[model samples]
Target: MAAVAILLLVWQGVSVAGLVPRYMLPAPVEVLQAFWKDRGALWNNSLITLQEAGLGLVCGVSLGFLFALVMDASPLLYRAFYPILVITQTIPTVAIAPLLVLWFGYEMTPKVILIVLVTFFPVTVGLLDGFRSVDRDAVGLLRSMGASKKQIFWYLKAPSALPQFFSGLRIAAAYSVVGAVISEWLGGFGGLGVYMTRVKSAFAFEKMFAVIFLISAVSLLLMALVNGLERLAMPYRKVKQEEREDSQ
Candidate 1:
């Protein structure tokens, strides 16, 4: 918090010093004022982006989880699909966004698809790595005890994968929101992206800064929510950390 305050102070000082033109770099105060003045419009647009992000996260995380499960179940599937997953990510999203817009039209589908593309890779990779890292000895023990594959997965692999899954989710949360906004940049009816475009076109730099800051705050909030979920999903982890702190 102190570091952020210092940074803001430096920004305000620089603007006041006229190091850059006011139009090019508005002061924090100007941005804040614009934020307050345009709060209604911003809120409405923000909800749309948030909805797009939420739905995208759901779809992306679901698909990624399913993909990881299939890959884990069969080494052949892993080998076949793993490369395709990696290759898909190599394509720049900016390039893909326009293509998706063209195919899906200027609706929410393309934006959702864009977010899913940005989000799924991390989750797939994380879950795959986690599943693979499971102890073969433990797996063998379960097999020797006449445990079915489903039982082994439920008791062993799924729990092991959760931490990594949550890690991926955190990354995906931020990416999901940003991806929606970027898709809106190409073409959309209303969203933070559309709002940003309008402000930029009208030379409303203060509002531009306002929207940028709002987007960042929203992203941070989403990440924080993920962290809370991680804590919930792994209560033992939190307890262990607390024990360590007490001992220290």
Candidate 2:
């Protein structure tokens, strides 16, 4: 917060002192005023983007989870598919967006697809790593105790994967909004990106800044929600932290 305050103060000083033109880099207060003025429009557009992001995120996570399960279940399948996954990510999203728009016709489907493509890799990789990282000795012990594969998975693998899954989820949460905005830029009836395009065309730089800040806020909010979910999903983390504090 202090760092952000300092950066804002410097930005204000530069803008107010005419070191940078206001049109090129508006003062923070001017951006705030723009945001306030367009609050209603911004809210409406934001909801549209949020809906796209949320749907993409849910679908992307589910898809990645299923892929992770399949790959973890079969080493041959992992070998066959892992390279394909990495190859898909190698294609730049911007390059793909226009094609998606062309095929899907400027609707929400392309945007959702773009976001899923952007967000799923981290989740798939994180979960694969976690599932592979489980202790061999522990697995052997569980097997010695006559544990079923399902029992070993639930008791060991699933719990082990939660940390990495949430780590990937945090990244995915941020990426989801960004993906939605980028896809919106290609073509969309409504969204922060569409609003930005309009304001930019009209030379409303302050409003542009306002929308930029709003996109960032939305991304942060998504990440915070993911963090909250992580806490709920792993209450044992809190218990461990409390025990460490008590020992200290």
Candidate 3:
């Protein structure tokens, strides 16, 4: 709320001062009005983008976790693939977006694929690091008890890795929306990216700002949801000594 208030004050000041032309940068009130006027269309397009982003996030995270698990289980696989994964991220997505569009056409499939590509690397690296960073002594103890590899991974490695997995999840959630938008910008039927292109073409600066605001809101909501899930998944982690003392 404080940030919004500050932004509104700056926006209103800029509008009153006529620093730049109104068409170039509309006032917050004007953007809000435009948002209301285009609410139905904006909502529909946003929903489409959300679906693509959500599905892509799911696919990317699932694949990344599985790959991380495989790499964690096999040192040879990690040695073979880690550098390749690093190299993949070195190529700019902007450079690849056009090619993706060219190959996949302006369909949801391309957008979802782009989102998956963008989101996967962070998750894989994060989870891999988490898995590897597990306490060696704990694994040794488990092994002494005749715990199999699968049992050790399930009972020890995975639990220890949750924090890092959630860290990567937060990063991936932010990227997912951005990936969807960028892919849509290259080519898409409906989404904030397409809506932005249309508004820019029409010189509707206020509407564009409104769409931008909506995109930020969506990203923020996603991050908050991930945080909530993290808390739910690791409730015991939050029960610190202070909490124990208070309960006693």
Candidate 4:
């Protein structure tokens, strides 16, 4: 709330001072009005983008987790694939967007694929690090007790990795929305990206700002959802009442 208030104050100040042309950078009031006027269209486009982002996030994270597990189970596979994964990140999404459009055309497939590409790397790396960074002492103790590898991984490594995995998930959730929008910008039938393009072409600065605000809101909401899931999945990580009292 404080941050938002500060931004609004600055925006209003700039508008009143006439620092930029009204058409170039519309006042917050104008943007709010534009948002209200186009509420239904904005909502429809936003829903399309959200659906693509959600699907991509689910697919990316699931595949990433499975890949991480495979890598954890096999040193050779890790050595063979880790560098390729790193190289994939070097190729900018903007460059890939056009090519994806060419390959998949202007449809949800390309956007979803782009989202998956953008989201998967962080998740894979985070999970792999979390799994590899598991307490060796704990592993040794489990081994001494003749615990199977599956048992050790299930009880120790997987649990230990949850916090880190969710950290990556939060990042991926934010990126997924951006990735979908970017892909849609390159080529798409319906989405905020396409709406943004239309608004820009028509020189509707207020509507552009409105769409941007909506996109930011969507990203923040997804991040918050991921944080909630993290808390739910790792309840044991929460500070116990006794621990809180002792710390105090």
Candidate 2 clash pair list = none
Task: Put down candidate 1 lDDT per residue, 48-74, tens digits, no spaces.
Answer: 999999999999999999999999889
List lDDT for all candidates, in order.
0.95, 0.95, 0.91, 0.92
Q: Residue 16 CA error for candidate 2 (Å)? A: 0.8
Residue 61 deviation, candidate 1, in Å? 0.3
Tens-digit per-residue lDDT, 54-108, candidate 2: 9999999999999999999999999999999999899998899999999998889
The runs of at least 3 residues in candidate 3 whose Cα sits more than 4 Å from the true structure, single-residue gaps closed, are 241-248
| lDDT (tens digit, per residue) of candidate 4 on 32-91 | 999999999999999999999999999999888988999999999999999998888889
lDDT of 2 at 120: 88
Q: How would you encode candidate 3's per-residue C-alpha lDDT over 1-248 as one tens digit per residue?
A: 99989979998899979998998889888999999999999999999889989999999999898889889888999999899988878888888988989998988888888888888888998899898899999999999999999999899989988999999999999999988988898888898899999999999999999999999999999999999999899988778746988999
Global lDDT for candidate 4? 0.92
Clashes of each: 0, 0, 0, 0
Give the least accurate 10-residue stretch of model 3, judged by summed lDDT: 235-244
Q: Distance from true position, residue 221, model 2, in Å?
A: 0.6
Kindly report which residue stretches of model 4 are placed more than 4 angstroms away from their true locations once superposed. 240-248
lDDT, model 1: 0.95
